[model samples]
Target: MSAVQTQPGGGETRYRIAVDTGGTFTDVVVGSSTGDMAVGKALTTYDRVFTGFEGAVRRAAQSVGWDGDEVLRNADVIVYGTTHATNAVLTGRVAKTALLVTDGFADTLLLREGGRRDAFDSKAAYPPPYIPRQLTFEITERLSAEGEVLTPLDEEQVRSVLRTFPDHGIEAIAVACLWSIINDVHESRIAELIEEVLPGVPYTLSNDANPTIREYRRASAASIDASLKPLMADHLGKLRGDLLQFGFDGDLLVVTSEGAVLDVVDVLDRPVLLLNSGPSMAPLVGAAAAPERETVVVCDMGGTTYDVSLVEKGVVRHTREAWLGEPFVGHLTGLSSVAVTSIGAGGGSIAWIDAGGLLRVGPQSARSTPGPAAYGLGGEEPTVTDACVVLGYLDAQGFEGGFTLDHDAAVKAIETRIAKPLGMDVLVAAQAILDVSGHQMATATRQAALEHGVDPRGALIVAGGGAGAMVAAIIGNILEADTVLIPATAGVLAAYGAHRAPIATEFLSPLHNDTRNFDSASAASAVKELGKKAKFFAARFETVNPDAQFSYFVDARYPGQAWDLRVYLDGAPDATGDAARQIEDAFHAEHDRRNGTHDPASRVEIITWGVRVEIPRHELLSDEVTVTGESVVHRHDPIVFGGESHVTPRYRGVTLSPGQHIAGPAIIDQPTTTIVIPPEWDADLDDRSNIYLNRKEA
Candidate 1:
């Protein structure tokens, strides 16, 4: 794969551009070695994200006194991380897709492995299937679990189904069959037939897409990939064409769920990798920013949800058998930093009185359209943002650079919609809403830390976003984590993550077998093969340096156990056995930590193998060394909240020098976000200008 590179000349300087398209805003950050950083934010265009993205890019370039087209012409890499895929799934705006599965498995997508939609709630209903049963067609083909052919594929029946797809107005086709992971000949043939008949229509096959064990999961994963293919392809194509028109000749990369970047063209074939791309970038950026930290907890509170990820030993945790639609696709893959969980709790989450007259915060969101009631965007209902406004925690007059917030509407909405039904005063109701939302976030943080076998007390929580400051203290108290750090660019942290993200790719293959009897030489050969694949992908971004490193892992399971454990290896032959032992020990430690005991006598087996190749970007100066600065005491202003007023002093994020410390009961304001340090907490500025908050006693 050849890469397009641009050299600085003609009054141009080399630049790296990162564009993050969020629910409410699109942020563009341009970084150059000239010790200059330009940041731009614009209202996101939901109907066409590229319009906002390009606008932000141009604005960012203009801020630095450079033409956007000239900057694009001199840029080395342009990385994009968007919320399109996630929004599509959440809003149910996907294409009309049909699933072609093995006979007798038409209900596989609907069954969802017999797991309830909400595992904790007994009365919760299952989420509706993305593809309806009427669109799920069955084909006559059978293959044994061991890759043995049981019955020949019914080619005539497949052709007949293909003929009806066009008549049914199907946009995409997913071909999945039993045991296709081991033998995908039938599925491939089906895909070929569909393509021949449908021509331009997109088609996906299970074995080619995931190639992991478990029939239903593989099928569902492939179905999701196929379903999103047309949409993703169209979006990427438009973005690429638009950038090219804007004079960007550099290679275009998109962030993946694994915290690495892949070429936009490659992403079209594996759109599933982009499922959690936007939310996953923050942890990666945080980890890179603080490489020395062995363990850190990242809490990214966006408009719609709060995503928490745990980073241990400078790497994000991954899952081997994550549920796509729930049958269990055995593909070991990279996921978001907080692999344990994410919850629907954020600034724009809706707050309303339930049928039982109990106040409930979202699962439902105001999103970008009407937004929160405080946004003054025709939102008549009270929301979390409205609660913040009514409580006076937010400065309604200065919201979004004096974009104008309707405080009266916010209060009135809360009074009639939430306060009246709950039989409480508006101020008290607002406080209750804030407390509940904070409690929900705190509980989620505790659960994630505990489930990951991590001690919450030992982890440093890094909080970012507009809502993070409001909830950080509560979450920190509940998790028992003594230190919490908030970045200066908290609101645009994801965008920064996109800026600092590396251009890399991952390759995986299953190797289910007994580890004790496994051929280490064959495993090494497989690793080499995957490395070649990764190198092939990485070539599109930069020349592969001989010093480029490769990380390997083997997914193992105890014999007779359904779940597997991932064990990282350093790519040495003599250490293979020791690696296996270390993996077993880690598994025992994890199991003991989770279940209070471990069966040491259980035999372990290796299920899959994977390799990730990373190509780092140009290094920037570290924000570690302390700089001398004077501590200026600013006068306090009264902030009315919870039916009372408190004097809160404000500081600027950019003006805070390293080592400058401040006591709590203060507000630190930045253009992107505001951090409220509650009483009993103290904050210290770190090398990177990140504010670390700790309890006074601690």
Candidate 2:
């Protein structure tokens, strides 16, 4: 790919485009130097996500009195982040992939961690293997943990597997040897043989993907990557091709799970990085966009899940380990935000009663299909969205500007499915469902905070999503957070995050030496080499900016420890006595923070060093706008729940300007979502159009 030349400033117009593909809708946001903004949303086409994205982009451009082609021509950068890869894996829509492992590891995927899938749940069943056992071929290869050859690799066995690929008719291949991270010779040879036999078939190696220890997680990670490769490649290719055809000359960047952007070209081999990209970027960008605060938590509630992440010191904290047991086959090598947890808490999560006469909200969601019963789309189940409608939390006539909603049907569904079963009124049932869901979300938020050793009292909750706004105040109350900031575009914060992200690339390499007597100079040199790789990747976005800079860090751990910790260095170490001590201090501090203590006497080891290259984006203005309208409270109606009914009033969020405040026992309605301000809590709109909710003093 050729790098587009940077255009000189004065008299030149620069445009940027960001597209976020969610489970229900494809949101498009376009910004230009002319100070014009265009936003559009279209129902997602799961079968063809690119079609929906392009449609939304065209519509957004048209709304701003510009043609899609013209908009593309003026755009200097285009950033896209989607949940397609994640959705594919979760729904089992990925391509059939074949796995090649060491002779005794054919059942590795099935025998994950002694067949114990969930440590917390005694009866939890193991998830079906991504590839069946029959397709998991084994080859004779032996390499010790230290990269020494314990047994000579059976080249004949690998050749046999390659020859049988045609018979298996595998769409993709994943090779994960026991100790590939230490020595990938056998895996590399197998890949070469496969390429010779199956010329065009895509193959992924465990070491090449993650290169971290742990055979099972590596295999799982690699398997996910190979399974989703074809699907992600097709969608990304179409998106790039369409943009180019539309006259776009800018580099296209995709968000990664670490809240950084990666070139579209690199996504083919590292598609696993795209998982959780949507939820990850929003919190990072939101924190950066907000004023420098001490502690902040971002709650992004969408159609299916409510994702919460913590941020401090203008950076979102990353998890050193993968959460969901190697969803892909590879050595895990990524910086993920720590404590980034999500629950089945969202607007469309289905609510129903179980066999034991108990009310349950979800792990199962209605998604966008029939959506909520209030959507007037033939859905009979009452969801959180439907509960909002029946409880007078949502405006029946003003929903989506009266686009389409069967409020009456929603009420009926709640009455028949939830209320009648428990001998309660419809309003009561809806309120119970809403309250239970809120409690679940609040518990999750508290748990995440506690797990990270963070005190909620000092945390500022940043809320987004249509559903996030409605529950922000309540969550703040539960967590004892004094402020909850809901930005103007709360419903589409993810899309906004994509728009604000800088073009970025991260390069990583393992550091296998012992830290006590290790060569600090050699390690510093290795880090500098990785920095150069990152710089080269960032140069591709020269059209956006020519003088883009980069940042660096290293993943380190105490010797003999299983997990490593990340430490940011001032610069590459010089391998001198002073540099070694500085590196050791950094690791000590990080270790102390994570484990609540540090062992200065123990030897430290550097596992991997990484460098992130990026071009910083223009900071956004945070000035507050004046409110021009009065806070109008609509009449309250009875909402039944927990075998009782109570009246609940609704208020308009857009109408309430800065300095305006509303007391609880009310609902705040916005186009994208509704906020349920329970009794005993109060909400205030900030100067920046953010809604701040606080608990009422006793």
lDDT of 1 at 288: 65
Stretches of candidate 1 off by over 4 Å are: 1-11, 58-74, 116-130, 289-294, 320-340, 390-392, 395-402, 420-426, 478-480, 519-525, 544-546, 572-602, 620-635, 640-644
Best by lDDT: 2
TM-scores for the candidates = 0.88, 0.88
lDDT of 2 by residue, 1-698 (tens): 22222335556456778887776667777877655566666656776666777777776766546676666777877778788877677677887789999888887787665455355675766656667899898878789878898888888777777787777768898989988876788888888888887888888888776756556767877888888788888888887787777778887888778776777888877887887677876676568546588767788887778888888867777774545434333223243433477888888888889899999998687776767778776678888888877766667776542256678988888898899999997777887888888888988887877788877778888888657876677577667777777776676778877777766656667656566788766676776788677777767667667878766777788867866777887765665556667778888888887789998888778777777677767643234453437777766766442334558777766577777778766777665556666676777776666666677888
C-alpha lDDT score of every prediction, in listed order: 0.72, 0.73
Model 2: worst 10 consecutive residues (lDDT sum): 325-334
Candidate 1 local lDDT, 306-405, one digit each (tens): 8887788787765544443233211222232226356778888888777777778886778767777777778887777788777655666545422677
Clashes of 1: 3
**How far off is residue 207 in model 2, in Å?**
2.4
- Candidate 1 has what TM-score? 0.88
User: What's the lDDT for candidate 1?
Assistant: 0.72
